[model samples]
Target: MDGTKALYYGAVALVILIGISVVLSVISAIIGLATAVISGIVTLAVLVGIGYVAYKAGSWLLGDDDSASLDSIGTGSSSTSVDAGSSRQDRLRKQYVEGQISEAEFERRIGDELETEEIDDIDRELERER
Candidate 1:
C-alpha cells in the first residue's frame, strides 16, 4: 500500500483499540463499584449485629435484666397476667397467717414453691402459646 494509506489505516486501528479499551475500563469500573457497595452493606449488617449483642450483654451485666427479680424468680410476663400464681403458695401463706405453719417451714415452702412454679409456669405458658 502507499505510505499515506498505511498511516491512515494505522491511525484508524489505534483509535478502534483505544475505543475498546475505554469501553472495557468502563465495564470494569461498574463491576468494581457494585462489589464495593455489596461488601459495604455486608460489613454494616455484621457490625450492627455485633452491636446489638454487645448491648444485650451490657444490659444483663449491669443488672438491668427485667426477667428475674427478688420477688419473682422467673421471666416476668406483662401481657399475660398470671391470675393465680402457684396455689401451694396461697395455702402456705394462709397457714402462716393462721399461725399453723412455723416461720422456718413457711420460708422453706415458699422457696420451693417459687422454684417449681417458675419452671412449670414458664414451660406451660410457652407450650400454650406455641
Candidate 2:
C-alpha cells in the first residue's frame, strides 16, 4: 500500500491498541495481575509493529537510492548551477530600463557584453553618483 494509507492504518491501529490497553488496565485493577501483564505485552507488540510499519513507509516515500540523502540531493552534483553573474546582470538591466541610469552611463556600464569589469564599473559609478 501507499505511504499515506499505511500511515493511516498504522495510526488507527495504534489508537485502538491504546484504547484496549486502557480498558485492560481498568479491568486488571478490578481483577488481578495476569490481565495487566497480557495487556502490557499486547500494547508493546502493537507499538513495535506500528513503529516498524512507519519506518518502512518512510523509507519507501524517500527513494531507496543512496543519492536520495538530503545532503547528497542538494549538493551541486544533481543539476545545473545557477549563474550568479546573471542575477547581477538582470538587476543592472532592470535599473537601466527604469531610468536609474542615463543612456550613456548604461551603455558605458553594459558595453559590449556582461563582464565582471562592467558590473564593477557600474557599481563604482553608481556609488560615486550617490
Q: Report the alpha-carbon TM-score of model 2 versus the true structure.
A: 0.27
List residue ranges in candidate 2 displaced over 4 A.
Answer: 1-31, 65-130
For model 2, how does the per-residue alpha-carbon lDDT over 1-130 read when each residue is reduced to its tens digit?
A: 8999999999999999999999999987877677778899999999999998988787888865444664464543322222445565677789889999888887776664466646655665675577
Pairs clashing within candidate 2:
none
Q: What C-alpha lDDT do the candidate models reach, one value each? A: 0.81, 0.71
In candidate 1, what are the lDDT values of residues 75-104, reduced to their tens digit? 355323343455667889999999999999
TM-score of each: 0.51, 0.27
Predicted candidate 1, C-alpha RMSD: 13.3
Identify the candidate with maximal TM-score.
Answer: 1
Query: What would you estimate as the lDDT of candidate 2?
Result: 0.71
